[model samples]
Target: MTEQSAVLARPPLPDDGDLDLLLLIRHFELALLDLFGQGLLAGTTHTCLGQEYVPVSLRPLLGADDFVFSNHRGHGHYLARFEDPAGLLAEIMGREGAVCRGVGGSQHVYRDRYMSTGVQGESLPVATGVALHLKHTSPGALACAFIGDGTWGEGAVYEALNIASLWRLPLLVVVENNGIAQSTPTACQMAGTVAARAEAFGARHHRVGTTDIGVIRDELAPLVSEVRLENRPLVVEFATHRLGPHSKGDDTRPHDAVREAEAHDWYRRYAQSDADRFARADEIQRDRMAAIVREVSARPLSRWEPCG
Candidate 1:
């Protein structure tokens, strides 16, 4: 781990609200795995797992008017933005209250100003275009897109960045650099760092090593403001971990790699450092998610009608 990431290996845990949000995402993801394991759900889902803090930290920083484009592993992104776990759960489970009427399932959810897709590198260009629109139509509202480090390989990402930089659009790219992409280690696929790539396109780059929500928000607040005020493209890369498999049962890392990821996980660190606080919060969310699963599963399938 980087020295910066080590700065908060122990917990003087975040405020209650932050802790709750983090655990909520954690438990929601855990429930997804359980549901998948038991054959309770169909279709594919990607859980953010250890990287939940990325969106949790940015939730308060983002405005409702700002556009958010999410990638495959974006449950954290959605939950953090809307805080409507029931809707998301229903969407995933194909229940009556689904956000997208059960058609989008896990990856292709759409709500006002927030959208997510299963395809890699697909959202950036769309986000870039939206940023341009936000720049002209809604001055302060920016477009933020979450992408994995593996997405750096896509030429469309670079194209989007070039236009975003040239047009001085309010584009914020959050890169979750989890070291591995699907079954491939990033070291095996990436030639240069995400920072270097963003710099090459004249977009500003910021590295986030610490998992502390307050610290991350404080650090990025100014940069985010810069994106809004100056209308420049910024890439904030998080040195994060993915504790679960790439998808369900698709992890290809060696045993030691998984152990290393676990060591860096914020959940483990917080639980170890302040068990009294962490345990209660974790248990509450876990149980709450369990209740949600039961409730959503019992609901009838959602019906979708084509718009006339």
Candidate 2:
């Protein structure tokens, strides 16, 4: 077996409850920032600093065999499923020890069942296709596509939605509406609401605030369960935000707006003390991650080999 495949064969993910998962996500993002700043991770990384709750909330509702299709800002989604921060950091740093053999970087990360694509709206169709396959072979399995509000303008997204709804496929389309798509705000990009479009497609849809994890879990657990059991399509629009700029070197918003956005972050509204706890936990995880990086960096790169 190839080295990448061997790494993929690591034991199954542990049963990480919601609280521990949240801490891990926060720490993972901080480690990414440190790596980016220290020049260890080459290329730009889209950090989901404030929006960590979206994926963390969704992780519990999903099964191990279920698939996740991620968009550009998908480090959280990848880590949520794989739970391999050291391997992910190595991937971003282009080390041979990375999960993808050091070729995918931050924009593209792929393992056996999880995938993150760099192109906007591209994963929508890919997820639709996967859902179709599951409908025929593994009726109990579900496929989820994570897209941003900016991708709403893409024709492929609507097409995928229509197709999934028509086929009654077990699909969950998650639109992470962070208000701003890159530097452009949602108001300037799309006219109608994402809910309206899903309605027109005859797909079940839900819109929820990102502040409360309980609210998210309460709303999604049944919907996800319904999709897997009934083989239907569901769309969940999470009202979240990008805590940082669109990506590294992409901060262009006014100072006042930035402050307002940060002030209104969902995590802040959820629990004031929790924020402090997260910060403290992040410091500890960052130190642990640094040690992991050092160890991974010491290993030789996985040799490249042709796939069968």
Candidate 3:
């Protein structure tokens, strides 16, 4: 009967299926990092902190027959397609039970037929070759390769881009520009926009801000769809943020109190607004986070072993 309650009850909150996916992804990343604290990991790891939704939206566009080639920071991409979280944790830990059987550490994790190479832009040419093969065997399937802004300097990417366009390969290149290549920011390193570089190769291109979930769904859906439907190569640039440090090794930056406050403020606002209608989303997030904690706790760190 109160005015405030009436306003709240006027209509339910917006559907947040995508937001739910993001919550689960955040849980995954948090859990993996916790494992590192428990001494379950030996080699280095790259985190996809603020870039969860981009991969979540893009994953649905992929067909089961499609292939994905990822970069160093690719925990999100692998989890999007594959179901075995345990194997992923194991892979990062370098255990025999890992998805890649401990052979590939953080830089070389692979499983469920999905893979990420340590060498920057290495996957570009590999994915181009995969696309070429798919063109012959399974023309309907598409191949997606995810590279970071830092890797723009690599020669392999240009070679792959040139060949993919020349042959019209059915490949999707996603450049996740999180503003930094380690400590070096993109503004300092990138000479030109990634989309422009891809355009130079004659590839179809689109640039999307990853922070705006709505834009991500709208812009990327068609690019992914067209690549699958038309069997042609295309590239999408996702501008995102690195909410956390680059990795465990580096943590010496001056704390931006203002930025931290803003992040916390936004998080509270989103949580409060979405809690009423998208109740399941919140519940799923909480449950998944608990599950991740339990899973990591149950696994012993002593089992971890680097590749012989």
For model 2, the stretches where C-alpha displacement exceeds 4 angstroms are 1-16, 266-271, 274-280, 305-308
RMSD of 2: 9.0
User: Residue 169 of candidate 3: its Cα lDDT?
Assistant: 86
TM per candidate comes to 0.97, 0.87, 0.83
**How well is each residue in 1-308 modelled by candidate 1, as lDDT tens digits?**
36545844585788998899999999999999999999988988888999989999999889999999999998999999999899999999989989999988899999999999988999999999999899999998999999998999899999999999999999999999999999899999999789899899899999998897888988999999999999999999999999999989888789999988887889988898889989999999999998999898999989988787
lDDT of 1 at 180: 92
> Per-residue lDDT tens digits of candidate 3, residues 43-105?
778877767766777766787888888888888788777745667766776544677765676
Candidate with more favorable, higher lDDT: 2 or 3: 2
Alpha-carbon runs more than 4 Å astray in model 1: 1-8, 306-308
Per-candidate total of colliding backbone pairs? 0, 1, 0
Ranking 1 against 3 by lDDT, winner: 1
Task: Report the number of backbone clashes for model 3.
Answer: 0
lDDT of 2 by residue, 196-303 (tens): 999999999898763557767888898889999888899999877677888875789888768766764544443344455555554566677668778877777666
**Candidate 2: global Cα-lDDT?**
0.79
- How many pairs in model 2 have backbone atoms within 3 A of each other, for residues 3 or more apart or on separate chains, i.e. clashes? 1
Which candidate ranks first by lDDT, i.e. highest?
A: 1
Query: Ranking under lDDT, best-scoring first?
Result: 1, 2, 3
Query: 103, model 2: CA deviation in Å?
Result: 1.2
Whole-model lDDT values for every prediction: 0.92, 0.79, 0.72
Candidate 3 colliding pairs: none
